[model samples]
Target: MPRMLDVSDEVRAEIGDEEAARLLAGESAPGSYDCTSCRTPGDSAQERTSTVLFIGDETAVLAFAHATCLPSQVVQVTEEQLQGAVRAIGGTGAESPQQQYQSPQHPQQQYEAVQQTPQEPQPQAANLVPEQAVLGVTSGLVLLQGELHPALVVEPTAPVARPGSLGSGDDFLPLLIEQGFMPLTELAGVPPVLHGWSVLLAAGQLHAVLQPSPNGGRPVAWWQAHQPLQVTDGWRAAANKHQQVLMFAAPVGSIGRQPREDLLRDALDKAAANGKLVASALPLAGI
Candidate 1:
């Protein structure tokens, strides 16, 4: 029996036409599988299913999702993220520094905060940030129009200068705007989805923020964590609920280290009012 699968040209290119044909002929495709986007059971024989290929540095994993939740495409990730996902899927008791940790009592608060300090600088030649500065990421649930949404706030520790430019001036928000991030005066509604950009959450933890590559093959890491940061279960739930993450950016010192969600919102609003914030809704990886 033929399956109701939508194998995209991009996905087919990665998996090859022959393998894609096998999937279309129902020779290798699963009859029933959980949607990678929503984690809900989907029957490919009855519903329009999408083939999502997650390509990593060393390996690749082909996953499935419902057409409505996510389209058929390829999502690039790091080798560590792929390994972590394998562990999560296998229920291995292995523990590492990047292991996912959750505390029931402090469900909303991150277990480890020190690991979030800025260190990793990706694509050094591109000059993402100043040589002395680092990006600081904070996770929280943002309230927009009386509803909660998963959010990641990005701020640099120092001013971000333009690539190959002399003199020190912050081009943080402007650079993001060029990359499709929208400026906001108020949090009226969800920001528009920025294509070619996505959040990396592997093993149920915050991993990295991916951006369109300079040379254009796979999306490169715009902001990568020194170690995977554990987010609140509530934050993860909201991300899965909406299938997107609200990403906001501000210049250095615009939105400082906010200790609480309420504080984070207050800082965000202040940044927006001061014209220091830009945002966009990025779909979770696997789309």
Candidate 2:
């Protein structure tokens, strides 16, 4: 039986005409599978489904999702990120009939990344440890306008200075504001989309936050997880439903790692009340 799957041209190009035809002809596609975006059961033969191609440096995984949840498209990812996905995905990810790829399963690590850049340039001795300049990232679902939205809270572990500024005050929120993130007075509604910025999630895990490169070739990682950080299934479901993720950034100590969602929300509210929160919504990338 031919599967009712939607494969975009870009994805088709990457997979080649022969492979694409095989998929369209119901040769290798699955009839029943879990939706990559929402993590719910979806039937490709009964309803419209999207074929999402996640391509890494050396491997590619084709995952299925409801067309309503996600469109058929090609998603670019790093090999490490892809392997991370494969580890989490297990048998849920597929590519072609002749090939089944799996990475050496590794223990899942769950920690968000924080970005720390000095506000001003300073002349210092070379050899600096990268870990000292890090940002702390937290993932939780936020309730807004009667809907729950997946959000990422970012803060530096220490005062963040501009890349080459001489002055030395925390510039985390200010720098984000300059980049088009709007300051939040309250969390009553969703933040506006931050163009050219995206949050990458593969296999329902948080991978990295990407920002537009100043040089304008490809976007660069603003904050990347040391390893793929595991997120709650609720967070992933919310992210897939909304097709975006809200990102809130504050200065150091504004929002710490809260052990629970309620605590996280409370911290966000406190940050807003104290006028220390900035937020924007970025389109969700990958699965």
Q: What is the lDDT of candidate 2?
A: 0.73
Best of the candidates, TM-score: 2
TM-score of each: 0.68, 0.79
Mind giving the per-residue lDDT tens digits that candidate 1 earns over 4-95? 99999887776667667877998777777655544457888999998876666755566666788777877767666665444433235543
lDDT of 2 by residue, 1-287 (tens): 89898989887766666667777888778777767666668887899988887766677678877898889987666677666566545533333223443322211311111111112111211111133546777788999998899998887778877777676777777788999999998898999999999987755567778788787754667777755676777888788878899999888788887999999999999999999999999998865
Error of 2 at 104 (Å): 29
Clashing pairs in 1: none
Q: What local distance difference test score does each model get?
A: 0.71, 0.73
Kindly give the stretch of ten consecutive residues in candidate 2 with the minimal lDDT sum.
109-118
- Segments in model 2 whose C-alpha atoms lie over 4 Å from true places: 91-131
